[model samples]
Target: MRIMAFDYGTKRIGVAVTDPLQIIATGLDTVHPLQIIDFLKRYMQTEQVERFVVGEPKQMDNTPSQSAMHVKGFVNLLKKTFPAIPVEMMDERFTSKMASATIAQSGMGKKARQNKELVDNISAVILLQSWMDRKIY
Candidate 1:
């Protein structure tokens, strides 16, 4: 089974997944907020998801960011819809900026770097990788 991560935003939700061995995280896709459940349902039909990691937006003061309020419903829905799968939250500060910098350093053209969907997808990947890096043993 693989672990999945979500970088949730009001308009779009980014998706990423780790391999069954949980060594590497890969960008999966970006889907509309309303479609996340359906998307996961379809994805789970083919892939066995072991757990979910969600990006929790935070402010400089270490308090929950305004966007965190918006993510509550999405988190609730995930737990409700997939009761068996566990959910985790990881700090997501600067992930978008990191993804942008990664895209820039990748030699991607300006137009491709400007794609919000791609940014979101990469942000999810970064979030998942960061979480994995924090794991012990």
Candidate 2:
């Protein structure tokens, strides 16, 4: 079984998946918000997903961020749609900045680094990896 992660946004949702061994998290793709459920359904047909890790936005002092309400709504929909799969939330503060730094260090082209979708995908990877690390140690 594999684990999946999502960085939910109004326009696009970043997706990531763990290796079968649950060791490494890789960026999967960015899907439109409207298509996330359908995309997951189609993906699940081929891959056995064990759990869903969703990025939860929080304020610096630990209060829910403005975007947290939207994420909570999406999490509700995810639980409703995939009752068998457990859902988890991981704090997502600074993930976007981390992703941007990662992209810069990778020496990706300026245009690619500037792509919001790419940032989202990397952020999802960061979020999933953080969760996996926490679980391991």
Candidate 3:
């Protein structure tokens, strides 16, 4: 079975997927928030995703941020839409900063770095990897 992860934001949703064996996590794409549910529906049909791990934003003091509530709403929607699949939350802190640094360190040109969507997608990959490392053997 494969697991899917989402780094949800107001503007975009970054997606990542684990291998069927649940070993590797790879970035998929960044999609507009309005389109995320439709995107998941199409992708899940083909990939047979078994679970969803969503990144939940939290403050430095480990308190849930306002965005965490938004994420919770999204998770609730996911459960309603795909009741058969289990949904889990992963704490996401500094993931966007990490993604920005990795992009800068890659020596990409300004034009490429200006693509916010790319950074979101990379952050989603990192989020998924972190979640897997924390929970999986």
Candidate 4:
């Protein structure tokens, strides 16, 4: 089984998944908000997912951000859609900025750093990795 993470957005949702061994997270795909469940269904057909980790955006004070409402609604939908699977919310503060910095530092070039989809993908990876890190200590 694998652990999946999502950096949810109203427009685009970034996806990442851990290896079967739960060793590391890797970028999967950027999915449309409307199509995410279907996309996940198709992915589940071939891959056994152990849990779903959704990014919960937060403000500097650690309160829920404006996007938190949307994320909560999405989480409800996700639970309804996949009743057996457990879902978790993780703070996503600065994941995007971190991703952007990572891209800029990676020397993937100017155009690559400008790609929101790429940034989202990396953010999801970071979210999952953060979760794993928290579990360790």
lDDT for each residue of candidate 3 in 1-137, tens digit (9 for 90 to 100): 88888989988999999999989999999998889888888987778888899998999999999888789889999999999999998988998888888888999877766788988898888998998898865
Ranked candidates, highest lDDT first: 2, 4, 1, 3
Q: What does candidate 2 score on TM?
A: 0.98
Task: Supply candidate 2's per-residue lDDT for 14.
Answer: 93
Candidate 4 per-residue C-alpha lDDT over 57-130 given as tens digits, one digit per residue, 9 for 90 to 100:
99999999999999999999999999999999999999999999999999899899899999999999999999
How do the predictions measure up, each by TM-score? Answer: 0.97, 0.98, 0.92, 0.97
Query: Residue-wise lDDT of candidate 2 within 14-119, one digit each (tens)?
Result: 9999999998999999999899999999999999999999999999999999999999999999999999999999999999999999999999988878899999
Candidate 1 per-residue C-alpha lDDT over 13-126 given as tens digits, one digit per residue, 9 for 90 to 100: 999999999999999999999889999999999999999999999998999999998888888999999999999999999999999999999999898789999999999999
lDDT per prediction? 0.95, 0.96, 0.88, 0.95
Candidates' RMSD to native: 0.9, 0.7, 1.4, 0.7
Error of 3 at 124 (Å): 0.7
TM-score of 3: 0.92
lDDT score, candidate 4: 0.95
